[model samples]
Target: MNFPDLQTERLILNQLNEQDTSALFAIFSDKKVIQYYDIDAYQTESQAQQLIEFFNKRYLENLGIRWAIRLKENGQLIGTCGFNSLNEKMKHAGIGYELAANQWGYGYASEAISKIIELAFSSVSPFCELYRIQGDTMIGNEASEAVLKKLGFKEEGVRRSSGFWKGEFHDLKCFGLIKPEFKAL
Candidate 1:
């Protein structure tokens, strides 16, 4: 399916156009933001250029989808959020989001993810199996964990040494919401 322009009550979830690359870089550039990410440079304009190229490639490939989050009243780029990982065999995708540190404590993350849950589990036909939504949070990211919980994702398990960040091992919290369980939300 083509990338979509999804809307939530307070945000317009539009596909990342040219104007969003720098804002994307801005979020990644913050060390505080990048600290929990699996692979992030925080930011460098050069890396932003590379990221823009990468997003274009993946979007064309239908392997990923991304949206630039903007306030409905103004189009300022607050952050980019969307699917970043996929597994065809598993018939599931990992949903992710990153926001400017300054934008925290608002309902944006939860609001954005609510739409993703619906999209993931939307079956095209009676014969189509549903897509499951999964997320992994580095064990220390309490804020992320809270967001996932508020969004109705279940804590499936914890992988000991689940992820390696900055060459050091850290447990990663695994989360998921299957199609059957989502409607209850």
Candidate 2:
């Protein structure tokens, strides 16, 4: 299947390719960007390359989709946002995203994520089967939590010690939005 490219007023969400390796590395390598991210900050370009490949592989396998968020004006890759896990039969998916530290507070994450939520819940989109989209933020990541809340995801509860990374288990704030709850902006 062809990768679906999505667009917003200020951004473009498209496939990650080898040409994006350096930019991807730049985003993932920043300590600030990955502080709440599942993985550690990237130490090499190869890690970024591998992540790009993993994203493509997920798309091909129909497990999920991740888009490189690019600015429309200068075509700079600023971040990524999409379903990290998709379950068609179960009609649910888990969404994930991150941005370059310099790009924070610009509402780019919200803009890109809004588009993804629209497509995921749209009857005509490839991800139409998805009835629910969930986002989990590490407990202290207020920025991410705010983004999710602004998009209509209600806080389900805290998942205590549910996530393990950075050498210890961490609490995750669970948020979820079902089709009925999403009001497109």
Candidate 3:
């Protein structure tokens, strides 16, 4: 499937490219931006390059897609978001997203997520069809939880020591939204 660019009133979601490497690194390497994320703050632009490549490869393989979020007015990259791993046969996929610290509390994350949810649930291709969208964040990440709740996801439970990253285990709170729930939103 080809990657599709999405737009909202204040933001645009497009494929990550070399031009975005620096801005992408800036967000990922910031302490506040990745505070609750499992991975360590990126230490080099090479990591961002690898990440861009990874995102594109995921799309080429029909596994998932990640869109770089930018402001509509100034065209500045603000964050990244999209479905992570996808299970086409099961009609489910995991959602992941992050934004720059300076861009917090402005509803950009929620807006971008809502748009992606609508597209994901509405797309009907064999590979793009998704019945359920799941988001798992570090336990105690209230900001992420709020975003999920605002978008109509229901908290299922916390998986104890579910995520192993950066040499330690972390609890993950799971949130899920089905097609019907998204439609109601």
Candidate No. with top lDDT: 2
lDDT of each: 0.77, 0.92, 0.91
Off by over 4 Å in 3: 123-127
Residue-level lDDT tens digits of model 2 in 75-100? 99999999999998889999999999
Q: Show where candidate 1 strays beyond 4 Å.
A: 124-129
Q: Write the per-residue lDDT of candidate 1 for residues 45-82, one digit (tens) a residue.
A: 76776776786577677676667788887877787776
Misplaced by over 4 Å in model 2 are none
What TM-score number comes out for model 1? 0.89
Per-prediction CA RMSD (Å): 2.5, 1.1, 1.2
Question: Which 10 consecutive residues of model 3 have the lowest summed lDDT?
Answer: 119-128
- Residue 32 Cα positional deviation in candidate 1, in Å, after optimal superposition: 1.6
Ranking by TM-score: 2, 3, 1
lDDT of 3: 0.91
Give lDDT: candidate 3, residue 72. 99
Put down candidate 3 lDDT per residue, 6-105, tens digits, no spaces: 8999999989999999999999999888889877999999999999999999988989889999999999999999989899899899999999999999
As a TM-score, model 3 comes out at: 0.96
